[model samples]
Target chain A: MKAAWSAEWLKLRRSRVPWMTVLAISVGAAAGGLFMFISLHPGRAGDLGLLGAKAQLSTLEPSWPSFFGLLAQITAVGGVIIFGITVVWMFGREFADHTAKDLLALPTHRAAIVAAKFAAATVWCLLLAVYLTAAGLGIGLLLGIPGPLTVPVAAAGVGRIFVTAVLTIAITTLFGLAASVGRGYLPGVAVLFAVVFTAQIVAALGYGAWFPFSVPAMHAGLTGADGPSPVGYAAVGAMAFVAVTATIGWWQRADHTG
Target chain B: MAVVQVAGLVKHYGAVKAVDGASLTVAAGEIYALLGLNGAGKTTTIRTLLGMIRPTAGSVRLFGTPVTADARSLWGRVGYLVETPAAYPELTVTENLTLMARLKHLPAAAVGNVVEQLGLRPYAARRARELSLGNQQRLALAKALLGRPELLVLDEPANGLDPAGVTEIRQLLKTLAAQGTTILLSSHILAEVAKLATRIGIIHAGRMVTEIAAADLPHHVARALRVRCHDQDTAARILRQGGYQPLSNLDGMLSMTDERAVWHPDEVATLLVESGCPPVHLAVAEEDLETLFLRLTARGAGA
Candidate 1:
């Protein structure tokens, strides 16, 4: 398992996947700041030719708490897409590059290979989450919003953002399984997009609490004021279990003809 | 001792049988080639042998141990390259070999050794994506040869290589076999495998049609007696009345493969002459490998 992990780590580090994921989360952080800037000064919406964008900012507050909350919300949606692609590419490239065959007859077990990929992906996604928070902190300081960032408040806000990122990463495991079963990046990406699109519709229908994929976004308050119920967290837990087990089992037992 | 043992192997994708009842045994220190055409189950058989695919029936054992995904220790002495060569395009050649060496539990020096062995030192720092087709194949082979395993299973290892590269690989496999390494390779070229393999197995339409010793291949070659003469119809009938079964080639010339006709063409000439029909062309010829493959594979002719 250690050898397999080292191999996975080297491939992950040498590839463009980490850079791409970092860019995605960094951009999302900056975009959150821009949204806050527009929310704080509504008059600039029209004066800067931003049209009626101010109407959407009516519920937003130009405070540090709000900034952190906004960052958490973006992490929900952005983490799924970015982290999902990272995991997808990790498993799918073996098929896309036609390198899967070489790994099958190795001294290391197939389950060990799958676990190593999961480990590398987990490390990468967590690093991206850290970057998102740091970038958001820098953006918030630059905006100079007048509000409380008391130690407890800051801890709570940052904790919420990290929690959202962890939950989002959990769902991305399904993307890894999809890529392994479907045998390429496009299949897993298709599943990722489908889940992201359906999450909005499911959350809008008031059942986001039960839909695992929508649980993270709703817990981060993507759907207005309502946060996820306890059942939503259970759903996420169930999804992580199922996805991780299926992926490992698939790697161990599937006829990897490709 | 036999290094590989496959028996009654079968694999089916829905209604399509990919490999049905294919069986072969490769002994230690023997260079065995699985000779087959495209879609002849060469890749499927190789995958099953490597435990990359599960067989619907039959079993594969390597070095006296049954092949299974969980038999991790069994793979330490095995190295392989199945189907088309592949590598992490983003990683340099040196990096790729280093990673493989780690997975194989070999010392780091294995990387530099394979790079030098495969003549990849010049391109060590180049990413796999930057390599040409032939060089990519070299990298794959280098990975397979990294730990110097006791057995090597290479499926079409010579694909995309130049003639010189092909000769080089053939010699390398021969040298390895001479040093007690067992090799199971696949190729559709009879002439190519004949030059290297001590034994050959022919497969077609998902079945093993025949297995032959390389030295005895001369006897199994598709040899035929050909006769062309004036009044071709009369000459053919005369040969037929002489208890010889004849068939016409696409060129409208009569041909037969009976041992009597091929070994005693002078008897045919005398018969045609007595019938007052002079021969224009008469000779014994061997068919090309493609034709031989068809004859051996048709209806599992030699199975």
Candidate 2:
């Protein structure tokens, strides 16, 4: 297991997608900052109405720190996109380039490879999430917001973000495994999107966000005052169970031919 | 004891049987070559042996132990290079090796030795994508050799290699074999196989048709001697009367075969010279691997 983990870490280090994700998150955060500045100091509301209602109304009080918080939420979505690409490339590239044959040829168990990749993807997502959260807090504080940033609030925020990132990674890893085993690209992305979209709809209907798909969104939506509901925990648990089972099954049964 | 043993291995893709009841053994310190045409189940057999694919019916044992559900433990003693070298395009050549070494849990000092040995030091810092195809192959080779595995399974190790690269790989394989590393290599390149393999197994349409020793190949493979005589008509008549089967006329050279006895080129030359029929040169046309392989596979396909 240690060797597998080490191997997984090496794979992630060699991959470029993680750095690209970091760039995307940083860019999103910067754009959020710009939007906040423009909304607060708008020359004219009539001229800037085209941006969005959020931008127009964002001028009320217009605390730069709060704007950073909003950007953090939006950038969290970028984390998902990054997770998607990482998931796709990690599993898909093995089949795309036919390296799975070489990988499977290693004196490792079939299940270990799958588990290692999942662990790697989850850790990558978590790391990125923490970075984004810290970046948001730093930018918020730097921009001179009003409220004192308590350690508990920041810690709670980071914890939720971590959970959300893990859930997203788990869901996407299954998609990746499916894509790899199925030997295709678009199908995996489509399935992942479908699951996420369905979960969003279910959560919006005043239902519990405890479904496997809803965990990421729930994590993203929960702020300092909005702790996780009992249903959210159930949803995360169920999804995790499904993800582990599906990954193991797919790795064991799917063809590892290059 | 055999280092690796495969028994009645079978794998099917829908209606097509990829590896049909194939079995072979590799003793320690032996270089075994699995020779076959495309889709002849050579790759499938190798994959099954590595436990990359689950066989429909059969069992594989490595070093006297049945392959476990978690195969990672077995990987420590094994090195494998698939048909095409697979490396991380985003990583520099050295980074790729370093990562593999770390994964294999090798001593920190051994990494540099492998890099230098594979001639990858110059390209150490170049991203894998930046390297040429041949360089990528070199990196792959370096990765496989990182920990000096006890068993090495190479699939088409010389594919896409220039003559120099091919020679280098051949020399490397021979050196490893000399060092007592058990190697299972599969390739369509017969000459390379002939030069490196101590034992050869021919697979035709998902089944191993024959296993032969490299030294004993000429004796077991049936071929003919082409005898050129001073008079074609006299030679043809005499050969017919002597119960030899006439093959083809290569321009002016006449080909004949006598399967009843082992062909001695020197004896045939002496006999032809004495018969007043060998005024010109005489040569023995023993079956090369290409011909033998074609015959074995063609016969299997026909059946």
Candidate 3:
């Protein structure tokens, strides 16, 4: 397992996909800062043109809580696409590069390889989440939004954002499974888009709490703060477990013809 | 003990039977070459043996242990390069080899030794994607040789290699065999296989058509004596009178496969000369591997 982990880590670090994902999350954080900038000084709306005019309609208060909520919302939505790519690449690249066959007969267990892949994906996704949070903090401080920015509020806000990121990351285990079964990134990326679209429809129909994909978005206040119940979080956990188990099971048992 | 024992193995993917009732044993220290055309199930059989594909029937045993993905302990003794070799395109050659060495539980120094052994020291710092096809092949061979595995399963290890590289790998395989490392490989290069393998298995349409020792290949090849004489009719008559069955091919040359005729072609010439039909061309020809392979595979196909 250690060997597999080391190899997986080395592969992940050398890939450009991680850097691409980091760039994506940083861009999202920068956009979040721009929105805060517009909201903080709506008096200059006419001077800044259409974007500023649009920002004039902002309902979010110029406060730390709102800033954190905006960051969480970005992660919940954008993170799925970015982090989903990470998981997909982690599993899909083996097949795309024609390397899966070499892995199948290794002395190390297949489950260990699968576990190591997921471990690398999790760490990678978490790093992006951390980057988004840190960038959001930097942007907020630079904008100098009103409010004390109390430690308790900051901690709570960061905690909530991370929880949302973790939940979003958890659900992406299914994308790994999809990539393995479908034998490339296309299927996993297709699944990601389909799930994202369906989650929006389902959540808009008032079933966000029950839908695992929507639960994270709702809890992050993309929907209202009357967010997911404990049952929703449990459902997310259950779905994550099922996805992880099913992915490992597929790796262990499937005839790896690729 | 045999290094590999495959018994009545069958693998069917949907309606196609990729491998049907194939069986062979590769004893320790012997280079067993599986020869086949494309889609003849050679790759499928190798996959089944490595547990990369589950057999629909029969079983494979390596070193007397049944092969399964769970047979982790059994795998430590084996190294395999199936189909085309693959490596992380983004990683350097050294990094890729080091990763494999780690996976194989070999010392970190094994990477450097294999790189040197495969003549890849200059390319060690190059990314895998940047290497040419032949260099990629050498890198694959290098990975397989790491830790000096007790058994090597290579599929077309000579693919993409230039003549020199091919000779180098052939010698490498020979050295490994001499050191008691059992090798089971598949290649379409019959000439090379004839030179390297101790035994060869010809597979056709998912079945093992024949297994013959490399040393006995010449014996198995069909040999015939061709006689073209001044008077072919008289030569045939004299050959028939001499109790030798003579058959004429489309080229109008009288040919005889009878052991008596092939073993004593001088007797046929003497008989023909005495009967007023002196031979113009009389020579014995033995079948080469290509001819034998074609004949056997065509026969198998017809059957």
Best by TM-score: 3
> What does candidate 3's lDDT look like per residue over B38-71, in tens digits?
9999899888888888999998999999998888
TM-score of each: 0.92, 0.85, 0.98
Candidate 1, residue B27: Cα displacement in angstroms equals: 0.6
Q: Which stretches of candidate 3 lie over 4 Å from their true place?
A: A50-57
Tens-digit lDDT track of model 3 for A61-145: 7899999999999989998899899999999999999988877877888899999999999998998889899889989999998
What's the TM-score of chain A alone for every prediction? 0.95, 0.80, 0.97
Error of 3 at B139 (Å): 1.1
Against the native chain B, what TM-score does each candidate's chain B reach? 0.90, 0.90, 0.97
What's the DockQ for every one of the candidates? Answer: 0.76, 0.49, 0.81
Error of 1 at B155 (Å): 0.8
Q: After superposition, how far is residue A219 of candidate 3 from its true place, in Å?
A: 1.2
Most lDDT-accurate candidate: 3
Residue B93, candidate 2: alpha-carbon lDDT: 80
What proportion of true contacts does candidate 2 retain? Answer: 0.57
- Which whole-number lDDT from 0 to 100 does residue A166 have in model 2? 67
